[model samples]
Target chain A: MYSILDNSLTLRTQLFSIVGSILLLLIIINLIRREYLKEGYSLLWLLMGGLVLIFSLFNELLFSFSNFIGIDYAPAALFLVLIIGLMLISMHFSVAISKHEKRIKELAQENALLKSMLNKKERKRKTSKK
Target chain B: MTKKSVCIIIPAYNEEKSISSVISSIRKISRRYDVIVINDGSDDKTKEVTEQTGTGILNLSFNLGIGGAVQTGLKYALAKDYDIAVQVDADGQHDPRHIPQLIADLDSGTDMVIGSRFINKTNYKASFLRRLGITIFSNLILFTCGKKIFDSTSGYRVFNKKTIAFLVRNYPIDFPEPESIVKLLRNGFVIKETPVEMNRRATGESSVTPLKALYFMASISVAILIESMKKY
Candidate 1:
């Protein structure tokens, strides 16, 4: 809440928080513009932004929560939690993508089969006609 | 006897036991029609048996699931320019004799024909979870696809040139049956379901266990919803 440029290590942490939040905001903006990520998943990003904004504006409560969690630094603790959560979600997405990739491959192979069958049938039809 | 050219695409996985009977039954009825068995990376003698039957076989390098295997058959039908394509199960439940009725309807200008087990009888039974999953998925398909689908997951169906062409271009590789109908309709293709009886599976257990049934329905529902929404 206080003005930045303080000499305290806490101020340095706050400076990083400001930078990270801005980067996240920019990412959200870019994703929305590109329409790559669906709205269903963007809720997580919105939650992240809300959490960061809360930490940036109200430093005392976040620190107490961090202390409650037994971390010496709340921002660092928050960052760690975010990283773990991201890793889990990323793993989930990787599974989904893997399933989709498998589906695509299956379809491709089936398509190839159909093509070969059609050719054999064509050859038979021609021989019979002649 | 008037001969008709039909292609039966079977998606088989570890189905070595029943592939012989399945292929032979179809051959007995439609000798002129071609059969393509998609070996979905089965680590069994399914590929061997299918090859011995002298039928067309496509070996997938790995297990691609049922949807992937069937889509592969559709792609072949479209590419080879078959008159009509029929999707028959590798398991012995679906009767190959009824295939002619499906193809007949397709010849009568039907874009797609489905063999409905629930039309005159409700003899098909599954786990309660599977039934519920099918119900919910059918409703979702109805909502999104703007059509009432009686059997959303039935693999026994017939496709005309129109349906085959569309599927070759863009086929749903997951939860294909019900969702593929939506894709076809969205692209202005027509679909029809004819009443055809199905016996209990002759061999092997069903791939859709209760837990997997839930996962299958939820994942496929999401895929269908997303894919349909993107159709524009």
Candidate 2:
């Protein structure tokens, strides 16, 4: 509805799509480095974002292919599907992460216990010399 | 303050209704021992109740079972340099008043003091099967450690610094007693027993159902045997 020029708004929408994809990519990257997102698993979304960004940059070719595939607004449909799929996958991964948080806590407590034991042994050795 | 400082560690799981009275009972004896309650990821008001009682609490964000909860408590005692450590239940099955007797044994230089129900009398009100299971395992613990342990599964016990240090390093996550007794004896640490009458749980059901009791006995027996085979 906001299309000013016939093809001009399509160009603007493609630019917006590319920018949004890049922003998502940046967020995913930040999450990866922060250890909130593990690697190999997150690589799929990163690549998908990149693919969407690339698809947005080439407009005429994608439209021609969409016409060939007999799907109206293939780019928009693909974008919607990808967003919904990613949301579901993100939800699934969050559940997995939530499940592992307990294990991580147990590991942390075990680590603390190991450190405590080591310090006590060191103390014992020092005291034994006296 | 060198009265062989004892810290009673209670590993709580979903015992909000009973934990306050547990805390209060301990508080009555708080002048003798510091109470530390490990609220092990209860999906209830366990933490809130513990906090209301102003007991020292370590709130685990998720459930790590009773074994992990108790180990966390042991780690805390080891870190804080507590001279003696006691494990008590938050469900109020074990009386807090019996804590002094364990400490008294510890004061007499017993490295570990276990409150045994069968030590003086056989009036323990456990189910027949439970009594049988305890008898079999306690006998095995006696054979392995060369010391008769009338109650191998009692949580009410005291450990001195040496035993605490050893336990913090290697706590049996399951079937802790039979293995622990043997471990203490093998390490040349003194172990003693005291008689304490226990009450039926004030709230909550025992985790050991008849079916679970069978599983518990088998699993813990295996765990103890495996632990015995492990070198140190």
lDDT of 2 by residue, A67-121 (tens): 5656566565465657876887788789888758646756857664565467568
Q: Write the per-residue lDDT of candidate 2 for residues B123-196, one digit (tens) a residue.
A: 56889878888888877766666777788888788888888898877666556666677777777888888999
The models' CA-based lDDT, in order, is 0.78, 0.78
Enumerate the candidates' DockQ scores in order: 0.27, 0.07
The DockQ score of candidate 2 comes to 0.07
Q: Which regions of candidate 1 deviate over 4 angstroms?
A: A1-130, B1-4
TM-score of chain A of each: 0.71, 0.55
* lDDT for predicted candidate 2 compared with the true structure: 0.78
Worst 10 residues of 2 chain B by lDDT: B170-179
- Docking category for candidate 1? acceptable
Candidate 2: regions farther than 4 A off = A1-130
